[model samples]
Target: MNFLYLLVVLLPIAFGVGWWASRRAVAQRSGVQVSELSSDYFRGLNYLLNEEQDKAIEVFLRLAEYNHDTVETHLALGNLFRRRGEVDRAIRVHQHLVSRSGLSDAMKTIALLELGEDYVRAGLLDRAESLFSDLVAMKAHAPSALRHLIAIYQHERDWHKAIEHARRLEAMTGEDQAPTIAQFYCELADRSRQHGARAEAREYLQRAFACQPACVRAFMLTGQLEAEDGHHAASVDAYEAAIEADSAFLPGILPPLLASYARSHQMDRAEKFLRSLLDRYHGVSPVLALTRLYRQRDGERAAIDFLTAQLRQRPSVRGLMALIDATMDKVEGEAHENFLILRDLTTKLLEGQAMYRCSRCGFGAKAHHWQCPSCKSWSTIRPIHGVASE
Candidate 1:
């Protein structure tokens, strides 16, 4: 029911109808039927434009009955029904197209594809899967079919099948699905880790690294596994590698990484690494981590000085909050009350802000996701770099 999409579909049909009307008019020298058909077509379009979908559908259905041989009209009607969330109507229209006696094999496959999509919209995934599998076997629209099958497998959490089909798609299309394939491996690794199958998890992580050498999620998982095994130094290495792999994920990576650095008694190394990040990565997270480190080692005054200097450069609300908290202890009476109010306001501001967003679809999230929940694209959701966020 997208207005533009409706126009695009109906305009072609109108042109065809007008052409047919001209032919009949020349042969019979009668304009009555042609005038009625044109009026009906325009009336249906008007009804659709006015959001009178029921009336529009009725008129289009009559048109379909009159032009039974026009396969494109049926296809467009089915697509329109699907887009309007009338999945049952869409399925019936596509089924009728597939069952028609004189339909070409090419047209039949297109109808089958449309029917499969309608099934998906109706949450009949098993039926959709069967239809798409048949299309793949026939090698008619195999790429599209494989993509849908991969989506279905991902929805069902069937990572093995998803990975297999992804590989097949890559080989078929030469699109280099390595990054997506790596994410699937990471998913498998996470599942194995949750089930306490450490070796299996490690194997999956290895495969993930093989697929994409600089995969940040794989490196992060490796760090987590090493940390769980009490190998703090190795965990530190993996975590640092993760940051180096993708600095955009620094906000998510910093906390656990800092903990590992502390447990391994690498505060000096931590300071050096954080300082290095400041040179290239302009984020409040690294600045805040450095502030805490300085407060623990060099004293409050030194921490405040460093944070104050960094804030002048970054201008982060989080940085401002840190500065307020650091100075609150030095204030008294009305000054202390004012500082408390400021802190609460900053906390509220931060609370409502989206910390992560999908680069592909612009879907905002408070937490990081490796795959976009909206577009289902892998490695597209990353930390939002702004004064209120990263």
Candidate 2:
């Protein structure tokens, strides 16, 4: 069990044992020793209840020194130290417990797990990696050890090892790791693309699609690859496929898709696709993009008319900025100057606003992240449909 869970199971037992021992000591000795032990016990409990973990750890440490058999207390104390960000102290406590000759295999494994966590928190990832690898080989806490190893590989950007361990974890636990494995492939693709390894990147993207056929990131990357090779038609097709896979990534796919449409002389097709988005998406990006399209094809009046009508349905600061820019050119002196001031205010209003939010963790970001930076959940961040955002 994890240390938090161990605390839940062991805390009451520790208190019960302490109370019983105090009662027995009262029968044998003068009330002095019993009272002192009782006072220390209650003080430690009070510290824990008050969230004064440092003082609680000190009290528990002293108690563990005096009571040689209090392994549970030491475990709880070490866990508290780790949770409190005192990794060195936690490592010391767990390392001591791990070295004790009387510890059972079960307890030793648990202590080793906690010590591995301490090493991870201390940024001694190599040490933690070695310890967890040993645990996995022993098949004693294999799932937990494999999970830590996967996390280490992810941190190290070792996608091949990460994929191997993740598959092992899935085989052991019967948990689906397909989506995560697809993301690892995507990461590999991105790294390959960055280093100008087109063939390797394409191979990785193919693997990603094989793992998850509807992988939006894989489609987007495919579109990017096609675009980089000046294959606008293929890029447009890939971008459209990406949208079909996941419309939630509309904001992310739109810019490249629009550019590809322009490069391929497909404005009519673009209009139809964006018009379709107007029905499906609540965000104002497509609306703003369509307004610009109308301005370029028809005239300022048509664009203004379209934006004004859309603004009635979905009011947006960005739409307002667009409308002001379109209107400002026709006006002069006071009207144009006032419009400039209003545009500045609207721009400032949107300056620090988050355009995206993580559905899982409620973390707001100015840009989209495929994995939530806060919760590390995949495909959770989406465009925030609001007046100041998308």
- lDDT agreement with native, every candidate: 0.92, 0.90
What are the runs in model 1 whose C-alpha is more than 4 Å off? Answer: 1-15, 20-35, 42-55
Best by lDDT: 1
Minimum summed lDDT over a 10-residue window in model 1 is located at 24-33
- Model 1 TM-score, all chains together: 0.92
Query: For residues 146-178, what per-residue lDDT tens digits would candidate 2 score against the true structure?
Result: 999998898898999999999999999999999
Candidate 2: segments with Cα more than 4 A from true spot: 1-15, 18-39
lDDT per residue for candidate 1 within 1-390, as digits (tens), equals 597987798889789879987886787657886788677878887787787878888888888886687687688789889989999999999999999999999999999999999998899999999999999999999999999999999999999999999999999999999999999999999999999999999999999999999999999999999999999999999999999999999998999999999999999999999999999998799999999999999999999999999999999999999999999999999999999999999999999788899998999998888888999999999888889988
**Which ten contiguous residues of candidate 2 have the minimum total lDDT?**
29-38
